[model samples]
Target: MYDRFLVSKQIDQWLAEDIGGGDLTAQLMIDPRATATFAMNAREPMTLAGVEVAGLVFTRYEPACRIEIHAHDGATVERGALLMTVSGPAQALLTAERTALNVVQRLSGIATETAKYVRAIAGTKARLLDTRKTTPGLRMLEKHAASCGGALNHRLGLDSGVMLKDNHIAVCGSIMEAVKRARLRVPALTKIEVECDRLDQVEEALAAGADVIMLDNMSLETMRQAVALVDGRALLEASGGIRLDTIAAVAATGVDYISTSRPFQSAPAVDIGLDEA
Candidate 1:
């Protein structure tokens, strides 16, 4: 679970966005003291996430609200499966409904998409890894969902790892020069990875003592050859133009990791509905 205060803060923001100054429908239709019971059920099959986050919303709206979670985050659930039950003031329930469902649905969609990629490379040495192309302000939550779906997270931000991409190489003049400069300036604990688009760059990166080499947009034959050329000196990763249909073949190149941003950026929101019982 995340920090209670932080969760409460997020819930507050969501609630404020949903009910700007008032919830006219709930206030007009229900008694101030009236209470209700409701079960939150999945309208379609999905991986569960943000259960605690959702509960925080209801609890914040109505301090006396009681929430019971039947399905935990990271669990796969079927359509119509009961996820949670809540009892509280009718207005409170109505106020928190959309906010709660929004968090759960978005996070669950990330988890579900991550699960598909993780499953695609099952039984292979290559691990499914996510890139930094995460939703703004939701990176932490989305990465947590990815971990829940069994995918390893790459560098969370630029500061975590040193990756020399094409632009960096162009600015630095050559792969060898970039790797050399990075190696000289970087702390010993930091691992240096160089992105190589051609076999010559691959050789340059390997000769420059790069700890890892990324084969970017290389054909399968070239990737296999690059892997063989690197031997066991540096870790190999394949990136660019990866999809579900082509992941297995990419993994077969014997790369240690495969990175894609599609899972987080292209995932569809999972379907979930909140209703009063």
Candidate 2:
């Protein structure tokens, strides 16, 4: 769940950006005192997300607006399914429609994409993990959408976890040294994860006491080998180039988790529209 106050703040900023000084078109054509009802509907099948945010957008625009949510977040709905309805001053609804639709469409797209990946890896021991690769201000919201589709969030941001990539290892002289330094700097409960591209690096990371070892871009054969080499010594995460087509195979490699950014980074916005009710 999101903090309404914080989300309302964001909605205000977005409304300001989109509405500017005023809604010229709405003002020109719509009666300022007129009241009308509008229904939010899915133009195509999708795993819905941000329905709450959409409601917030309308309420933020006109606090007196009456909203009825027919479908909640994470609901999988078919084409033409009604998601929500709002009745308010015609000008307010018309002005806020685009922003509300944009939020739902974008977030639902991520949820839909993530669901595909989740289904691909079903029955495997591996759980889907979403990466930090998200639109600048929408990381938290996007990750929430991913979770709606059954993928577990990896790290919210850099400060959320310790991930030692290849560059960090290069700077620290070796994986062992890098993990050692990380252990010294971070709290004992903070998990240190090392990205390894080869079996030898995996061995080094495990021996260095890494809590998690990420197998980056490793072949299926290599990933299997890494899993065997790790032998439960550390959590194994298979990342890099993991796609809907390849996720099942990656999950079959016996890794504990599969990390991918495609669900959020490359998803196309789902079709959603607002129509007069």
Candidate 3:
């Protein structure tokens, strides 16, 4: 669950950026005292997310705006399903409508994409994990949507975990050195993961006491060999170029986690529209 205060703060900042001086168009057409009702309907099937957050956006604009949500996050709704209704000052509803819709549709897109990856790896030992490739200010929200779609989150940010990628290895002399330095300062409970691009590095990382070893872009045959080499010494993560078409195979490699940024990169927004109710 998200903190209500933080959500309100974020919505307020968004409204500030969008509304600026005033809603000149709304002022030109609608009376400040006029009241109107609008209903949100899905234009296609999608795993809904951010419905409540969208409702909150309307309320931030006009506390009197009454928002009724029929579908909650993670629910798959068919075309024409009513998601919510907002009624209040016509000007306020019109002012907030675009922002609210944008939030809902964007999050729904991420949820739908995540669900596809999740379904692809079902019944496998591997769990679908979302990466940090998220919108600038919407990482938490997008990850929440991914969670709704049954994908696990990797690291929330750099502070959340220790991930020694190739760059770290390039700078630190070796994966062993990077893991050693990270282990020295990271909290006792913090997990240290090393990204290995080859079998030799995988062996080095495993021997260096890495809590998790990410096999980056390894072939199926290579992954199988890595799994055999690791022998369950560390949790194996298969990442890089994991897609719906290839996810099942990656999951079948016996890795514990399959991470990808594909869902966050190009999740097409679900179609939704607001109509006069």
Q: What global local distance difference test value does model 2 have?
A: 0.94
Per-candidate total of colliding backbone pairs = 1, 0, 0
lDDT of 1 at 276: 67
Candidate closer to the true structure by TM-score (higher is better), 1 or 3? 3
lDDT of each: 0.87, 0.94, 0.92
Better of 1 and 2 by lDDT: 2
With a 3 Å backbone cut-off (N, CA, C), the pairs that clash in candidate 3 are none
lDDT of 3 by residue, 1-277 (tens): 4677888999999999899999999999898889999999999999988999999999999999999999999899999999999999999999999999999999999999999999998898899889999989899899988987888989998899999999988999998899899999999999999999899999999889999999999999999999999988899999998888999998988999999988889899989999999
Q: Give the TM-score of candidate 1.
A: 0.92
Model 3: how far is 142 from its true place, Å? 1.3
- Model 1 residue 83 CA deviation in Å: 1.4
**Candidate with best lDDT:** 2
- State residue 158's C-alpha deviation in candidate 3, in Å: 0.8
lDDT of 1 at 23: 95
Worst 10 residues of 2 by lDDT: 1-10
Candidate 1 residue pairs in backbone clash: 38-277
